[model samples]
Target: MPPPPNYPASARRNGEEGVVLLSFLINQAGQVELSKVLQSSGSSALDEAALSALSQCRFTPATENGKAIAIRVTIPYVWRLNQ
Candidate 1:
């Protein structure tokens, strides 16, 4: 699925730009199970946005010895202000 289009306009207006590190556990069912913010963007709004987007993301399950296995993945979101 495509990413959500709910980014806060204020963040852009304020020229907010930072990296959000997201840690999530991909279950055997190829679905996102646990999601957490490994690193934040300093701004609560940006962090929340990154977390929300990641929560809705789907990923291919990890494999171990030719079988699906739960695994952890880290995603980074770099939000840059339009120049």
Candidate 2:
């Protein structure tokens, strides 16, 4: 799947960088099951957008002994505005 769209232009205009810490559950089918924001950027809009984008992502499920298994993964999203 394609990457999530960039944050809104207004977010860029604000010129703030937010680090979103996300915890996601990867299922055996290589689909994302659950995603939660472990750390927020103090901006609800940015946090929600990051979560939404992540939900659309697909990943390779972790394997153990050559078998797929559910696992939790942490992802960090850094949004920086170009000056």
Instruction: Output the worst ten-in-a-row residue range by lDDT, candidate 2.
Output: 1-10
Worst 10 residues of 1 by lDDT: 1-10
Q: Using TM-score as the measure, which candidate wins?
A: 2
Q: Cα lDDT of model 1 overall?
A: 0.77
Per-residue C-alpha lDDT of model 1 across residues 1-83, encoded as one tens digit per residue: 32743666888778777877888888998888778888998777788888787777777777889999998888787777653
TM-score for all models, in order of appearance: 0.83, 0.84
lDDT of 1 at 52: 81
Residue pairs in clash, model 1 = none
Q: For residues 1-83, write the lDDT of model 2, one tens digit per residue.
A: 32654786666677656888889898998888778999997677778888888788888878999999999888888766652
